[model samples]
Target: MNVAEVMTTRVVCVDMDDRLTIVKDILDKAPFRHLLVTEDKQLQGIISDRDLLRCLSPFIGTRC
Candidate 1:
C-alpha cells in the first residue's frame, strides 16, 4: 500500500505552550487519539490519549 492511501490529510495540532486542559479538551472531541505539538510551525512531538491521561492524572479536580 502507498503512504498516501492510509495517511490522514487533516490533523489536530497544538502549540508547545498550550495547557494540558486544552490538550485534553481537544483530544476529547477529536476523532483520533494523538495530537501534534508544534513550535514555530515545526513539529516538536506527539501526544497520545494515554500520554495525556497520565499527565492529567496528577491534577484531577483542579484546573490544569
Candidate 2:
C-alpha cells in the first residue's frame, strides 16, 4: 500500500519551535508510532518512537 493509504492523515505533528514536552505528550497519547515534524505546513523530518527512546540513552541523551 502507498504511504497515503495507511499513513495517518490526521497526524499529530510538532512545529520546529515546539517544546519537547508537547512532543512527548503527543507521543504518549497518540496511536501513531512516528510524528511528522513540520513548518509552514511543509514536512521537515520524521520522529519515530525508537528515535525518542534512543534519546534516553546516556551516550545520546537528548539527541532527538
Candidate 3:
C-alpha cells in the first residue's frame, strides 16, 4: 500500500523551545507517538514516546 493510503493525515509537531510538558501532552493525545520538532518552519528532529519515557524515568532505577 502507498504511504499516503495508510499514513495519518493529522500531523502534530512542537517547537524547538517548547517545554517537555507540551511534548508529553501532544504525545499523550496524538494517534501517533512521534512528534516532529521544528524551528523556523524547518523540521529539526523527531521525538518518540519511548524517548520521553526515557527522559522522565528515574535515574535511580534501570541502567543509565
Candidate 4:
C-alpha cells in the first residue's frame, strides 16, 4: 500500500525561530511521530520523536 494512503495530511510543523516550548507542546499533542519543520512556508526538514528525545538528553539523561 502507498504511504500517502495512510499518511496524515494535517501535519504539525514549526518555524526555525519557534521556541522549544511550543514545539514540545505540539509534539505532545500530535499523534504522529514526525513533524515537518518549515521556514517561509517552505520545507526545511523533518523532526521525528527521536530528534526531540535527543534534544532532551542534555537535560534529562545522557546517552552512553
Highest lDDT: give the candidate number. Answer: 1
TM-score on alpha carbons, each prediction:
0.81, 0.68, 0.82, 0.77
- Clashing pairs for predicted structure model 3, backbone only: none
Error of 1 at 42 (Å): 0.8
| Predicted candidate 3 versus true structure: per-residue lDDT over 1-64, tens digit per residue | 7998988788788999999999999888777889889999999999988888878985634777
- The Cα local distance difference test for each model comes to 0.88, 0.79, 0.87, 0.81
Rank by TM-score, highest first.
Answer: 3, 1, 4, 2
Give per-residue CA lDDT, model 4, range 1-64, as digits (tens).
Answer: 9999987898788888887777788888877778888999999998877787878775545555
State the TM-score for model 1.
Answer: 0.81
- Model 2 TM-score, 2 decimals: 0.68
Best to worst by lDDT, what's the order? 1, 3, 4, 2
Q: Candidate 1: deviation at residue 48, Å?
A: 0.8
Give the per-residue lDDT digits (tens) of candidate 2, residues 1-64: 7888876677677888887667778889987788889999999998877777776665565554
Residue 37's lDDT within candidate 4 is 86
lDDT by residue (tens digit), candidate 1, 1-64: 9999998778989999998999989888878889999999999999988888777586755598
**TM-score of model 4 vs. true structure:** 0.77
